[model samples]
Target: MNKVVVKKIEDKEIVWFKNSNSYLVLEPIAAAILLKINKNNSLEEIKTWAFKKITAPKKVVKKFIEDIFLLYTVNNTLKKEVQNNSGTYKIPTKYYSEKYYSIHNCIFKIQFQTGFHLLKIHPIFAHLETESQNKFHFNYTIFDDKDFIVFFKNDAFIGKWNKNETHLFEGKLSMHLIIDIYKKPETDWMGVFHASAISNKKESLLFLGDSGNGKSTSLALLNANGFDCIADDFVPIDNKKNMYTYPAAMSIKKKSLKTLLPVYPELKNAVEYHFKKMNKTVRYLPPKNINYHLKLKCKALVFIKYNIEVELEINSISKIDAFQQLIPDSWISPLEKNVSVFLEWFLELPCYQLTYSNNLKMIETVTKIFNNDL
Candidate 1:
């Protein structure tokens, strides 16, 4: 009997580590070994069992199995949920740069203590920046506190981000915005996906891939062709499974310069920012034709890649494999009910692995998907 929730999807199994609010996708043999982990299974026995399942260096395999066993099979508690609460740290509000934005008709006044923190988030929402004499629904303040970058929602202490972990900072802000826009608590969100998403007005198509796998570049291409960019980097899906709009700029990489040059000629002279921590150079491209209040059902989950070796190919991938790729990079709800909803919505979605080299054909295939032609 496994202590965690293990669901079989095709050839892989997703092991839910509820204690840590985490998940692990395993190969069959690893899954078998993981289920059997306990004091009863000796170190040598588990390592020997792991040997029969996969091919690797004996010393490497032994170390890998030993680490896994010690991490889970031992009495040591599994990795717990990391809290980002701001404890004992306080900073005065300077609000040097202030702007107001309206999302879903809700006004939010965003204030930055310095321009450094402002540029991290301001560019994407620049289009939404507006002048308001009306009362703000919330005041989001971000400031550098020497050791960490702190965030506040309506002056209430929420959380702070580690200096090295800027993604956590932006991600938390994105979630807070989602909560404010939907008028729901943080737990109401089904999941936040680390993917670039675009829509055809009626519905959406979410592109999931590792960083530098052409997710944002594909979005910039599609936006030029026909689709509307919904969200980039952080996409939120509600409990009902509808994908809401996240008004943010598309961070296009330097390698995509020649490819998108024809579509966006102005990008040649666009200011570039080097994200040193992430080791990626990017330029922000504002989204176009987006519906400010649109909430759309997704039509497909595409794991895209720009492969110069091949012309173009779009193939159906196993939902299990897709979930394995998805779960690790995503933030799923810890609540049991919301987890159930996430699984239900995820399993039903059509998953595809799209590899393309030709721009026109890639756009055509995506258009066909939106039209339900494929």
Candidate 2:
């Protein structure tokens, strides 16, 4: 999230700015010219390069350089108003179900307007539920706004999700809790990845890929066998590069049901829910062996996949390729401090792709990674 990654398509190059999480697409010549630009290079030098390179006039390259080049690596200032409402949904007349959870030392009181709203949330924190309490650090009210579900954090509008977007709503809610539990504003977080993370007490490895990569299934299997799951789907890091434990349950997809049943037999009786947008039928497996207080240094980033008949293969991958796939699925803080930390942190870690069909080899491979034997 902190690199100016350049990936070449057939002819166009995608230039992505880690600072702003924005990108520009240009022809190879322009990309090469602009990428070669140095802050200290005088305007004349750029004009000379442009003349020899793209052969464009130096006449108006000044405006192009000042406007476009300057914007190529824009640094977005922190917004004073971070949560801009797309639309408003008023509080409901009544809430029927309520619960409280204590995550890392932070307590949250959530009152759901209906059981359906409760179902979207309560399953994940059923393990962390505490006794009824009128006082808490954060008050969240979930409304069953028709066609949309609205959320309020301490009476301030958080956001709304369409009825079909309960999954997105759950993810966003967890993010707000992460900010609260750490006692920091959203800007203070380094980044949050749509990845699964597992730790072995000393260090952590992040599993990232497109959907159907078996990232979360690997986490469930490893957690059932040996490793500890620190977070799933929505993994966050701080300015210190510590990946904290996220307490939500891991969703077990229908495709992996047979593979995981032998390990977690209770899944046979677990309720299955379908998400049409994602085309996934999943069962929520309550996270096991979570430290709750644990935060580990990230050891590596592994892009993983599982095939029915393929042998195990794991190898290093280009960071540029990895970042391109990662940025679209992640939320990296735009604040300069987090940006700086993310860049420095990413540069130091080794990136790998692990493809496997044999679960035994997969487990052994991840263990060796944690032990630095790989």
Candidate 3:
């Protein structure tokens, strides 16, 4: 109700509301009540109006009000601001290239040759350097967007771009850059794993599982318990077999909202997204601190599987089994001649398989593992 703005687009079915840090989608009924929210309108008045307008039961209307209030009360929500700098700078048509390494030291060199200025370098790579500016340049061009050849070097996958869909095109391009950085060939010492990592500034623990297997939930719980999240969804592993933080926003699915809302109240105002293919809703929670610890030696690895029917259970697993489980979801450097060395280093760490329905106990179990008490 406070500092919230609602607007209906011309042809869109869902109404949009701008909260402090992110935009929220509202159904027609919810939008009706949201549009009527004002400083003068009391809760009783809004509820009465909503019930009369929708012909729904009072309890249902009350629930809607509560949901809107939860979103309204969130503080310090992360926001995305768009800057329009079009037509301000000279647009080059010739070939231009940039090279840089991520915080985890994944090397990337992107070459762009275009006559159109609409396709500015991906915003994420704007701060990175060109090959000429950096001392070291990778052997292959990670991304090539020239007129004749527009594909990722390792995969040879070309992307389609349109001038009218600049925002969508740029977003896809950014995703490609992230993938290339994680799977670049020249960075033999680094690899990307499909896991979540958290640390206590001394040692890091990794949670490996498939998508929707509660990796983000575990990371969020760890964050609430005095631990810092290194990465969620995808983490980088260095030459020393250490897990490094990739400071992207943690994507929390809708089902985990009730579990996380109490721990992270700011999530109430997180940006909501609908994944059509997955048929699930998700929200992105920004990191607590943009500046996080970059390097962390992996203390342990736990393969987590959520089972609602069972309580917390922890079992030690063989290193060979862990290696096989990790390989399927991970993206490693192609130039790495021998995979055995990486596997050996990873297997040296303590590994376990955690199955639990209770999130609180899961956190406790993980804490005990880190302290060597479990």
TM-score of each candidate structure, all chains considered together: 0.82, 0.81, 0.54
Q: What are the per-residue Cα lDDT tens digits for candidate 1 across 153-260? A: 876887877878987888889899888887878777899999999988899999999998999999999999878898998899988888987878888899999898
Superior candidate under lDDT, 2 versus 3:
2
Q: Using alpha carbons, what is the TM-score of model 3?
A: 0.54
Please list the residue runs of candidate 2 whose C-alpha ends up more than 4 Å from where it truly belongs after superposition.
1-20, 23-45, 52-90, 114-116, 144-148, 161-169
Model 3 spans > 4 angstroms off: 1-185, 290-293
Compare candidates 1 and 3 on TM-score and give the better one: 1
Which model scores highest in TM-score? Answer: 1
Ranking by TM-score: 1, 2, 3
Which digits, one per residue and each the tens of the lDDT, describe model 3 over residues 1-374?
34444443222212223333233445666656655564556778887777778766778778879887655555225466644232332333345544454433655555554423312443323333334535432322322333222333433443444445554444444445444545533344456777888887888888998888889888888888888888776676666575655666677899899999998898797657665656878777755543334567888889998889979999998755676587666655433222333545564778899999998899889889889899
Lowest lDDT 10-mer window, candidate 3? 9-18
Task: Give the Å shift of residue 35 in candidate 3.
Answer: 72
Runs in model 1 with CA error above 4 Å? 1-3, 26-87, 132-134, 265-270
